[model samples]
Target: MRTVIRRTAVAVTAASLALLVTACGSDKPDAKKEAPAGDKGAQSSAPAAKALSTAELEKLLVEQADVPDYTVKADAKAKPVAAAGSAKADKAACQPFADAIGGTIATPAGQAVRMAVLTPKDSGKKQSPEEKALAGLNALKSPATRVLLGSYEGDGASEALNTVKNSGAECMSGFTVTQDGETTKITAATPMTLAAGEEATSWSFTMDMGGGDEAKFNLGLMRQGNTLASFYTFSLGGSVEELPIKVIDAQEKKLA
Candidate 1:
């Protein structure tokens, strides 16, 4: 059991928690279509938005100082989708949503920054030994929250946000995504209400990890100008019914 836990933990951290999910829900006919590349009218008339470079994004991403109770660090494993089509959705229309959960932007971004925010092992003071032990267990049950900040030029940020929204609406009940040969099954996807930045959207997912083991994964997105921020929460050995508001709030402030 411990070995399995360790392996699953690594995969979850590796954008494999960055994500690959499956769902049992039947297909819905409401999938949305994007404008054709050749359609000039499809393009926006507003002046192009300036995207923050990778270096700029790195500085803008949430830091340890901003989240005092959590350990925030760069995520070495979170990278762009593989060129070999390693991360793909079972339903073509759901690809954008899948990509968002896997630590990448749906619409292409000029650059992105990824980070992992680990929950504190204990909160408050004056804990008895038993209390400390229980706190440790609680901490173990709470998985790291992965954050991604993506910047785009032109209207890519809007495109990215729309793509994710449409996909979530289409596949809210379930879907499957495979990353590097392993599959992540999302048994349910529940929409969330959030107010931040220029626009925001979020979802809570029930991840079926097979063998009767399951994990709670909550995902949220917010866009400020040409930048979009994504917060991904994954919990194992237990359940999580809420999104990481603190992480979202911190990133939203930085982007603002």
Candidate 2:
């Protein structure tokens, strides 16, 4: 079971790298740019493309052929819940961490969101209950290596980027996750290197489940055009390393 978690975590981390790389390619409009008053009418006459709907955004996600040696499966669809009551920490200050699971700024409204999980072709047999539970926590677990991809379309990519960059400092302090009435405390969160995306951020954190059990988390975020993608990977009873640079390179080429 421990082995399964590690493998799944590593796989997801790679996928997360891909998502981040995808976001890096497109340039963000300058936040400070303001059109001349005289040109406002002309600009209004010709508008940007209508943002893709959630369904269209999902269709644009990287496919199996985009990532070698991995089988990409779409995650089961579910309703979006309000980003509240997902977690609680010993310190009230850490409550924000619960929002981590609530979907990123990239998440679009309505039911058009799409997500996929990537597992290595050689992942072997079925996963045990322990593995399922951990994976269920964030749906990033599998017997084989796994990576999760979630995409949403909206004209808010630039807005999302600003939100993440601004809120990251506060959220990094760490907190606890509460689900199914059970609590797991995350004691630390360290920022990871993220040089690929137009706007990207990564973090590694330690989750303490009491009784000597612990898990590590690696999370990455990226934004491109009107889309935003988020990646999450977890290791149970093990350490998680930084995502590889090649994963991003390969994914960026596919997006190109």
Candidate 2 segments whose C-alpha is farther than 4 A from its true place? 1-49, 76-97, 104-107, 110-155, 171-173, 244-256
How big is the RMSD of model 1? 10.1
Among these predicted structures, which one has the highest lDDT? 1
lDDT (Cα) of model 1: 0.61
Query: In model 2, how large is the Cα lDDT of residue 74?
Result: 49
Tell me the TM-score of each prediction against the true structure. Answer: 0.72, 0.57
Q: Name the candidate that leads on TM-score.
A: 1
Which residue pairs clash within candidate 1? 12-17, 15-18, 18-102, 20-184, 21-184, 21-185, 22-184, 22-185, 22-186
What TM-score would candidate 2 get against the native? 0.57
Candidate 1, residues 18-82: lDDT per residue as tens digits?
11111011111111112233111233455767777777888888887776545565656644433
- Give the alpha carbon lDDT tens digit for every residue of 126-207 in model 2: 5586654433443223212222233434445545544544554655666555555566566777766554444555566776
Provide backbone clash counts, one per model: 9, 4
What are the lDDT scores of the predictions, listed in order? Answer: 0.61, 0.43
Instruction: Note each model's CA RMSD in angstroms.
Output: 10.1, 11.3
C-alpha-based local distance difference test score of model 2 = 0.43
